[model samples]
Target chain A: MTDLQITVNGDPRRVPGPASLLDLLAHLGLDARSVVVELNREIVRRPRLGDISLAEGDTVELVHFVGGG
Target chain B: MLVDGPFASLRVTRDQPSFTMTRLGPLIFASMSTTLEPTELVDTPLTIGGRHFRSRLMAGTGKYRTNQEMVQAIEASGAEIVTVAVRRVDLDRTKEEGVLHHLSPERHFLLANTAGCYTADEAIRYARLAREAGFNEFVKLEVIGDRETLLPDTAGLLSAARALVKDGFSVLAYTNDDLVTALRLQEAGCAAVMPLASPIGSGLGLLNPYGIRAIKRRLEVPVIVDAGVGTASDACLTMEQGVDGILMNTALAEARDPVTMAWAMRHAVDAGRAAYLAGRMPRREIAVPSSPDRGMLA
Candidate 1:
């Protein structure tokens, strides 16, 4: 199986095809409960992470709350 | 019997005293049981985005020296809602020790803000990301127009507010003290309109009180004065202007003692709100004498 290239947090990386968002998160060693995932400029809700599969060239932005006023 | 009047109620009793007393207004009746006190006045709770907050003082969680200091200041401020910025999750760090660790959701409502976003698209994206992060739907929509002024991009803010409201997020749009823009945000279905007292982090206090008052008078929703608070007096003045709430950060965080300043802000908000509700006396150009002039020796 060929590796698919995807961008996460502006960094491009190669991951196996037919990977769910949950799989991608796990691959990055991220806890699913802590981060918010945006797939191609759209937020993929937490409950749908496992069901939604990532495609090649998918740009994902994972965001979380930080110290801010 | 409860006899209703325009501003107060007259209660008549058939007891031995047989007198009438008016409550909740300036009307004083001759009755032994009638005692007027400021504590008797009921304060209306500040409501925004369908949530009732006891503290009309919302605080920011930035610029603190440490997370412990942030927690201390937040506790001291007595703010029920705290604003936070949304950024890319640091994957290298453990989630347990993140900013949320210091804040208890049960005690405080985490208000996620699009602080660094410069456009509508960026703000909208941050709003969605915040929702997905389980911080609920409360979003402080800030679209900065430039780096120097740090003023909100009114056009982008309105567009972002409309989009977020349509997307089912409770938007609290940060805008300038411009009345038209504030009204436009309200019309865009924002839960609240947060007009800046001045530029962000400027510590200038409310530079345009008339503009803020005009916004408050015209809008039905909550008008929160966000940003540019220099001290507790600024917060007090803002609240006294009849704004629903005041959101501040540098005022507390940059103070010599952040915790103490937070406490001061908390009381200032309460004092201002009480003063506003109690109704201030009309301003006069000429001085009035308090002592009686009748039968006074020349």
Candidate 2:
């Protein structure tokens, strides 16, 4: 289990990643359908979220969908 | 090159008489501002699939380096709606990410796109999966039957759109800039028609603005300029041409500063809409300078 340093929703958190992003989300309790996921600069497609593994020092940004116009 | 229009036969020269401008100025000005007039503005705060969108800017979740940047860029974009393609998170494993953890459904309107599907059936299957995965009614129905052009297979697109709409899915279709096809999709009860400006990720500006304009003229549903947008100017140009909104991906993600580009895009979308509302002066055959009447008399 490699150590990964990343920020989720702007708060820095240290987690074991080298794990797939899907696993990370599972750890964080995120739903791929309702939220938008961006890794590095590109969007991680909902299907690829679990396939895309995390490396050390990778930054993950999760945008939750809120009610708005 | 041959020019076509009312001025095609005008033997335009630097010193020609200002007859054209003098006669057509008022009419020209009126026509220019006609599109810009507030009354000409289409419906705003457009609602689709029980979701309300103010700016009509829908951004794709792709091609960024970091998640924070994506979030920051998205926040900067001022888009209430965003798109995410559905794919299996793990090709190695069978357990799906279940579409719940990527986004908090309560925050933004989620648009599920069938990006990797090639046929109508594949697209339909994916749409159902997305619905089952909690997408429910909202889906960006993309049926790309081709690989090279990344153009929508009109037959496939039409079939899938009709099927999805029949299945009670609110479909926002991604299509080529073909007026007839767009009409067909709109007539099929699509919530929106997202026509490409050029090819996907080509970064080409509106390849055929006339075609897009034609679609806008005929279609009652929101006409969003999707794909092939390279910069903010491209987005603005589409909005100026009277498109209701824009959906872009690569252009923003590839920028030196994705966040800044997103902000620029927001302003561009607004400016273009404002310009369209204010109407643009018609392109005259010759420059209509505000020269003195005495000079004209000479």
Task: State fnat for each of the candidate structures.
Answer: 0.79, 0.00
**What value does the lDDT take at residue B38 in candidate 1?**
21
The TM-score that candidate 1 achieves is 0.85
Tens digit of per-residue lDDT, candidate 2, span B44-78: 35556566676567877776776667777888987
Q: Where does the lowest 10-residue lDDT sum fall in candidate 2 chain B?
A: B22-31
Candidate that would win on lDDT: 1
Model 1 chain B weakest lDDT span, ten residues long: B18-27
Off by over 4 Å in 1: A1-5, A14-19, A53-56, B1-38, B92-96, B295-298
* lDDT of residue B86 for candidate 1: 85
Candidate 1: tens digits of C-alpha lDDT, residues B1-298 = 4435432322333332312222222212233455632223334467788877767889999989888999999999988899988888665664435577788877899999999999999888778777877858889999999999989889889888988999999999999999999999999999999999998889999899999999999999999999998998998899889898999999888898999999999888877876776568999999999988797887
lDDT of 2 at B193: 93
Task: Assess the local accuracy of residue B113 in candidate 1 as a C-alpha lDDT between 0 and 100.
Answer: 92
Question: What does candidate 2 score in Cα RMSD to the true structure?
Answer: 13.6
User: What does candidate 2 score on TM?
Assistant: 0.67
The candidate that achieves the highest DockQ relative to the unseen native structure:
1
The TM-score obtained for chain B by all candidates, in the order given, is 0.86, 0.80
DockQ of 1: 0.65
